[model samples]
Target: MPAPRILGAAAVLVLSAVILSACAGTPEEAAPEVTGNAQTPTAAAPEPTATPEPEPASTEKPTCETIISESVVADFESLGWSAQESPLYIGSTEITDGLQCMWADFEGPAGDHGQMYGWAPVTEAEATDAQDELIAQGWQREEDAAGVYITESAETVIAPDAEGYGITYLFGEGDVKVADTKQNLLLIEWPKS
Candidate 1:
């Protein structure tokens, strides 16, 4: 996978974990497909049990503008970045009613001048776990007069809890914020250029 895809996958996993945590009941797992013949060459045959097919994935897609506010886009713009509507998707799974935006200086180096932001529903534990996972994955955690921060490199400062988490990767740094209800996660990433 490309670098962006990997980061997207991580974000997706964290989002999925948090959403899973918030659910009152777990979803049913799909049964394995049975491929072999039901009867043997010389044995008396018994009736085989039928297995139900898995449910189809939902076709819903979120209107991102509803989840990502104009003010938030302005915030990035204030920092000299241009907002780009980046839709988030992972194979067949995707976030409906979620936020996916990217900000960048198009003139900068190939992998050095942009940021990405994402938001999705999540539980408190899920949000916390996502923060911990980012730190564990080589991003350093720090606290200062300004606020808490996490960074993948010295030049980047990933702001913490701008309201979830602040995390940055090789390309840029960003933050994550969770709503008070513990039902949403906002992820921000600003790549270096």
Candidate 2:
């Protein structure tokens, strides 16, 4: 081959070799090291936990009166009152303390007025709260009564029949406390004329 051509070919070959060598080798790449002066990303702060509201006190067991015993009915009769064998449900709410009720009425001359007996397996706090509510609503607590806390108003009377028994009595329109328990609430309502 001619000298110029040989020189030109040699130059071309050398350029191609240089380009291949450069492409064949990979450059080392790594994340840059953080220095003391460099600002490192901080972890985000944890969210605040929320506190839950407390639930109201309630009776632990159901206290519904599905059936009123014959003796109980007779007791009403002895008391000069006529009671329904079946329970009648009044409205329910959170503050009732789990009470279910049934009604009894004066059979003869006092027919216009009646009594309501209810029951609930409630916590002590619940029962006390109910009694407190009645007194707060103008129900005068009965004086010197053992085994029961009775209260009276101008047209109503209410009592918790024996502590821890979960039984209550409401007469006339004065009863403001409601029943609360897991059991059905036994309630009675009699309006005054």
List CA RMSD, all candidates: 27.3, 20.6
- In candidate 2, how many clashes are counted? 23
lDDT of 1: 0.47
Residue 72, candidate 1: alpha-carbon lDDT:
66
Candidate 2, residues 1-193: lDDT per residue as tens digits?
5999999999999999999999999855544557698956554556699889898664233332333445555666677664443332322224343343444553456443444445433445654565566577665554222222434354542332333223223322223233321111232221111
Candidate 2 regions with alpha-carbon error over 4 angstroms? 1-69, 74-99, 103-115, 142-145, 155-193
Report the C-alpha lDDT of model 1 over 1-193, residue by residue, as the tens digit: 5999999999999999989888857645445445595533443445699999998775544333334456766765676676566544322224344455566665556565555555544444544555576566665665544334444433344443343333431211232322211112232312111
The list of candidate 1 runs beyond 4 A from truth reads 1-97, 104-114, 142-149, 155-175, 178-193
